[model samples]
Target chain A: MAKMTLDQLRKLREEKKGDMVRREVEGKEIQIIVGMGTCGIAAGAKEAFDAIVQTVDENGIASSVVIRQTGCMGLCHVEPTVEVVMPGMPATIYGRVDAEVARQIVRRHVVEKNLVENHIYDRPAVDIVKK
Target chain B: MHFSVSDFLLDLVQNSIEAGARTVTVRVVEDRGLIEASVGDDGKGMDEAVKAKAMDPFWTDGEKHARRRVGLGIPFLVHALRQAGGDWELESAPGSGTLWRFSFPADGVDTPPLGDMAGLALSAMAFDGDYELVMERRAPARGTEWTVRRSELRDAVGELTDAGSLTLARAFLESQEEPLDGIE
Candidate 1:
């Protein structure tokens, strides 16, 4: 297929920029990252990723949430891991996440601010040093 | 070792982008008892020596990631395709580009499902870079064919990165692949 002209591309980019800005200004503040490394993919991270995206979109919360994919987090055993980072909160990592678990993570942890106990995998442990 | 063909394709596209490709095209054609998938990229193509070594699972450029010591994308594909009685080819020149094509028996038990084509394509577009992606699928068994271009999509939906635009792109790609879902 022939490529689109530069003018056309620029026009589209401009038109979309306005929409993006408006959405960003109104949306909530949350970021969700899904592990999509080879191990993660083999363990069904793709489905979890899609499920999270679909749930967010269907709930009309796309503006508030930013979803992304990342390489392995050196936790191959816990394949299909998802990390959720919210404002003023420590990053939470959930492993062995499937489609259903992903939806719950979005609805509960992301929306309701309640960590789903069963699915929570990792929380940074504070270290104290006394001299 | 990907679970689905879409995942595999996504990996291939990632490889292309990592190779500095500005334009990537993927074509999947299912016909005559075979499924053929081809990915072409206008990237910094490898020389003959590198091309020959690309299939080695232990070989890598060792420059992209400081900790990464191996490249398994092409090697994995080669193993999977070979195990399923399939074949693959790679053509590249130092300054030109690269084209990698592989085909396997459509009815082979080891052949993976195509997975979510739309999701894969859209995800590729979501990469943080200035590039264009085109995906085409021709399923003779289902007597259907369709093509999606990122440039055209940008024209239709303003920007692909926008949430609304992404939703539209996903829906459009899904619609195109819906009819062919049951064929295989």
Candidate 2:
């Protein structure tokens, strides 16, 4: 429902300056994906996609970002889901994702180079509870 | 609440986006003896094995892909169409993309009749520059052939996000159902 303007987009383009570019995969980075299933769509996947793409573009790190799409990742409960892959780092899946969380992922992990522990979906530990 | 074939088309276009397709094309044509809707996207293409299981009622592409959840769309579509006296086809080449072609009796029970088609066509085509969605309607009796593209809307809307611009976008789609130059 939020509408974006060319000037606002351009302003965002300018303010973020060099930091908001898309990651250059040429360096060292992993593939990051947002599940685009039917559930996800109803849950707001497009907004997440826009956030991710906008972050990467604004920062100008085109090479490091490999954005891709996937079918249902089986987590309808978490409707809007995101998966981040980093070399040597375990692939992290985040559920209930929105634009805010997506921005945080880019800021903490992609920029500041630290993962946001609270937002991560720790399934192994959660699986223990099912028993 | 009640969704028509146009709703289904809109839903699938959203699915195509979830599949990570940068661009999606949708076409609906009623020619010869068939009325068909074809949706194609350049997203993550599933392999034969995965593709084979994709349409199964209970088959869900699991964690190897992403979060865990139940998947039941394509199968439902297949069922809904067959009941209406038609068949559905899905084709995909890994790393290339996926194509889903659904055909049903031009006038069938399984197929929800079309509704607010012009609106659906406009909304589906109005994606954010990234995904290009096209909707073509070709019907025999009316000889109506309408094609709507996202780029056209993009050109019209420009960067105007004021209340006026949003209203205009909504109005443009609403107005598309009227008599146009070429189609129908």
Top DockQ model: 1
Which lDDT tens digits does candidate 1 get at residues A12-38?
556655665664534557888887756
How far residue B28's Cα lies from its native spot in candidate 1, in Å, is: 0.4
Each candidate structure's TM-score, on Cα atoms with residue i matched to residue i, is 0.79, 0.54
Candidate 2: misplaced stretches above 4 Å?
Answer: A1-131, B63-67, B126-129, B159-167, B179-184
Predicted model with the maximum lDDT: 1
List the candidate 1 regions with Cα displacement exceeding 4 Å: A1-26, A116-131, B158-164, B180-184
- lDDT by residue (B1-184, candidate 2, tens digit) is 1245665566677667767788888888877766788899998888989987876756666544333334566665666676778877888887799888888677665666765666456446543336777667776555455665665555554321221232344455444444444545
Fraction of the native A-B contacts that model 2 recovers: 0.04
lDDT of each: 0.74, 0.62
lDDT of 1 by residue, B75-166 (tens): 78888887888888899997788999988898999887767777887776665567899989888767558787877776766554344556
Candidate maximizing TM-score: 1
Question: By DockQ thresholds, what CAPRI class is model 1?
Answer: incorrect
Fnat across every predicted model, in order: 0.08, 0.04
